[model samples]
Target: MRLIRWLVPVLIWLAGCLVVGRAADGAEVMLPEKFQRLLPLHEPLGKPGPFDWLAHHPEPGQTFGQYVASRPVVPDRRRRTIYVQPLGEFTEAQQRIVELAGRYLRIYFDLPAEVRPAMPLKLIPASARRRHPEWGMEQVLTGYVLEKILWPRLPRDAGAYLAFTPTDLWPGEGWNFVFGQASLRQRVGVWSIYRFGDPDRDDETFRLCLKRTIKTAAHETAHMFSMLHCIQFRCAMNGSNHLAESDRRPLWLCPHCLAKLCWATKADPEKRFRDLAAFCTEQGFDEEAEFFRKSLAAIQGRR
Candidate 1:
């Protein structure tokens, strides 16, 4: 019994380390082709670069990158509440984000997700904004700080990948300058859609980044439950780096992949997931609403 306890922790820790390393490698999700000009694949904005959350799937029995997307999402006879604990300086932001994320989960993932009232996501603001001429006074987002915000949350090892994203990098009034970098192709690995939000503006990036942020939150959370990139199918799991790539990819997972999603999450495919169009409509994404609606019906009907 003594040996088992000691060994269990050690083994669990070792397992966690491997997953953390894989997350750090990042998944390479593709964005919609039309939005590619705005975002791009090499950047790894919404989807990861090419990294799996567990670095690999935890339960390899059912499938590789696909989780039964909605099966585990069934109504919780018991209350289901998730919380975030932020570390370092910006505790309030982290806590509030957890609440916002819950709102998003219930709406998009169709999960009755809840946020615990007392639990506050810890926040550390050492790397909050950056110093840039275009960004005005306190606007800093100098670089990708996932290592600061997220990676440290890991205890050496945990899941497959570490999804590190800032609020968002949607185009604003001065977006042309922010994204009009000459290094778009050469450094897709290092370069992302965000440089800094407009210096003179207020919270434009925060609001605009909502759509992409939800995509990322849902994607990363799926990783936590042992889901993989839907790349093999023309679905959201496809790796993308730019906005266009994200836009091009449909919100629905493919049938084979959906099967895996069904297995992992145990959600009813017919009921749990909101038809892509419905999801888009709820999100006020009128642009792709019709397209995703059609896609979801076609995909679900066939199966």
Candidate 2:
């Protein structure tokens, strides 16, 4: 009993000394400073919590001229082209990026034959990444600037943001949070390799995560069209969770946003949208294929 008393007092005194020192230094006493403390509180704070993307806009400004100057363009005006050009030695998940992005471009924004799609998704040699290690996770999405990638083929009247995510995302575990981006960029990219197969499945613990990517990629591209994320009505651009969240999202834009996109791209709503669906099915998205079909029908019915 005596030993316990002495030991307890000393321990208490030491703790008090540390606390006083910390207070003197103006250090916070956040409980989760240690993993053990945070273990019981597994849930992250805030809505759209974790795995969130671009909390803000880029400093240089997200514009066409600046975006075009970032990279060189290569012409491939064939009716439909999806290039998976390797930027550097990339992981299989990264290399598959083209087909992944192409999967959505084919559905959401498949430009006509005149508007070629030059997706910069490839597996370059290790030397390439070594040469430019500073490239971010979402780097090279627009490796080919807007004009360079779409000019001579399609009109230059839009912007594109590639929400590159590490291949290990799930519904919500708060992966890859470096902070400082605007809320507009939150949850930007959906669950790829973050989903199912694609080899990223082994590392990713959930199977449902696979399908989520399809919806996400398409969602981000929709933003490139000058359309704000959906606010009214259940829409494809409503922002999402699992594929269901995305599925709940309608394929077409809200009437307001749709009007804006139409004004920006000036695509003949019915023909261009229907044709885009045809292109997606050609690439293998029966689900989105059907979605786009209905989207075209919905707009056409209005006309």
CA lDDT, every prediction? 0.40, 0.39
Q: After superposition, how far is residue 233 of candidate 1 from its true place, in Å?
A: 2.6
Candidate 2 lDDT tens digits, 1-303:
999988999999889856744553223222222212212212222234243221231122122222222231222232223222222233565445445555545444444311223333343222222222333333222212222322323333223323333432222123332211112222112223423344444534222233344455555554544344543344455544443345445444444434433444444556656766775566455765676666565554431
Q: Per-residue lDDT for 107 in model 2?
A: 40
Candidate 2 weakest lDDT stretch, 10 residues = 179-188
Candidate 1: Cα lDDT at 187: 15
